[model samples]
Target chain A: EAAVTQSPRNKVTVTGGNVTLSCRQTNSHNYMYWYRQDTGHGLRLIHYSYGAGNLQIGDVPDGYKATRTTQEDFFLLLELASPSQTSLYFCASSDWGVFYEQYFGPGTRLTVL
Target chain B: GQQVQQSPASLVLQEGENAELQCNFSSTATRLQWFYQHPGGRLVSLFYNPSGTKHTGRLTSTTVTNERRGSLHISSSQTTDSGTYFCAIGSAQGTGSKLSFGKGAKLTVSP
Candidate 1:
């Protein structure tokens, strides 16, 4: 099983506040993804990376920027957080692109007031 | 954009009963996956059946790429199985790892 971890399991920030969510995987997976889950929206991809320093835009990329500093680390930055950004964010990693199963973190619940 | 649709927005089943969930995709899915989400919010991969059929324990998943449809069957449901089931299809638009997810089927099992 792949071990994926996230920081600050829960977060609260005011509108316009800057927030960053971190994710790390120990399986040396080459693919990493960030997603947000809303009641009716399910899980929407925000960004993804296949390697360190590489980034790919997903279906829902607006207001979100991501960086893969290392093969084991990925970060999502919200420079100007809004109440709409409040969601349960999940980070996942896979050894291969779409061929393999992706392991997910416990999730981070962000609340923007 | 790829679209994944899951049916039975919500389901209720008693212990020992059988349950079935469906997933239909808008385009050809080279990678289809089923996930079970714990009430606490962790996602556990249940199956990765892009084609054909795969089974593990009390769960079975069947996917027909040509039809762009898939189904998940669970037997002997338990209270612990109460949560949400999500069906996600990988999109080839980008790195091929990007997935389009359906809203999910909320299942509640009672003892």
Candidate 2:
């Protein structure tokens, strides 16, 4: 089984504070993604990386940045957290071949005040 | 924006019964997947049927590429089956990697 792990399952930050959510995958997948889940809406992709040192913009890339330091670690960075950024963040990874069934991390809930 | 609409935002089922969830895509897709999210906040992979029909345990997923739709069927529902089921579709973008997810169907199975 593949495993994608996320850190700081829960976080509380003040407005204008910088926040970073980390994700690590043991599956050695080539693709990693960051998404935010809000109430009444489906998951919105924030950013994704095809490999180390590579990042691509997603549908909802504003107010967020991501870094894929290695195949095992992908980090989501919020330069200046705002109340609007408060949402449940999920990190997922998958092979380029089987993109449909991407393995997801447990998710990190960030609360921006 | 690509949209994947899922029917019946919520559902209630009794044990030993059956349930079905539908997903309709605005456009064609070559990849489809179904995921189960337990109340504890962990997502478990269910199926990755890009096209045609596939079954696992008491769950069956059928994706019709021509019709641009997908359906997930759960048979003999159990308490453990209570959770949100999400249907995701991958378009031609990025050579397959990013997926658009549905609003999900919240299912509650009772004894």
Candidate 3:
């Protein structure tokens, strides 16, 4: 079965801290994405990668940076975490063109206090 | 601009009853995906149909791409089916392939 795994299921960080969220996909999909979900707002894309070494900005990418280290791994970095960045973050993978169903990870709930 | 909007915000259903959720998009989408986020917070992909109709088990998804709308229907819903249903899609592929999502429809089932 295709699976997307995210690390540190939950975390609490102080303001001005640096936080990094990691994700790995066994699906070997060409596309990987990071999104944050908050109350009243649906999941919004932060950054996405087409493959290793490629990154694309989304609607909201102000305080986030992402790196695609390998086909199986993607990372989201918060250089200076803030209270507003506290939310549930999900990592998803999909192969474009012929594939459309996106596989999402369990998600990481980060609280920046 | 708001790209996608889901209807009912939330719904409560009785076991064995049917449920319908709506997703409307503002931009032209190349494709659309329907996801079921279980109460526990794990996401399960339900459908990936850009247009027309498709079904799996007790769920049916129909997307009128031309009209920029999609509908998901659940038949004989069960208590385990309770969760938030999300609709996400992209305007196109490549650099601008990021999916814009709807707020989601939260469903609660009572036995």
Q: Tens digit of lDDT per residue, candidate 3, span A1-113?
A: 67899999999999999999999999879989999999889899898888999998877899999999999999999999999999999998888622466778999999999
Q: Per-residue lDDT for A1-113 in model 1, tens only?
A: 89999998999999999999999999999999999999998999999999999999988999999999999999999999999999999999997777877788999999999
Question: Which structure is stronger by DockQ: 1 or 3?
Answer: 1
* Best lDDT among the predictions, by candidate number: 1
Pairs in clash, predicted candidate 3: none
Candidate 2: misplaced stretches above 4 Å?
A97-100, B94-96
- What's the chain B TM-score of candidate 2? 0.95
For model 1, the local distance difference test gives 0.93
lDDT of 2 by residue, A4-100 (tens): 9999999999999999999999987898999898877778889998899989888999888899999899999999999999999999988873343
Off by over 4 Å in 1: none
What lDDT, from 0 to 1, does candidate 2 have? 0.89
Error of 1 at B56 (Å): 1.5
What's the CA RMSD for each of the models? Answer: 1.1, 1.5, 1.7
Two-chain complex of model 1, DockQ on C-alpha atoms against the true structure: 0.77
Candidate 2 residue pairs that clash: none
TM-score of 1: 0.97
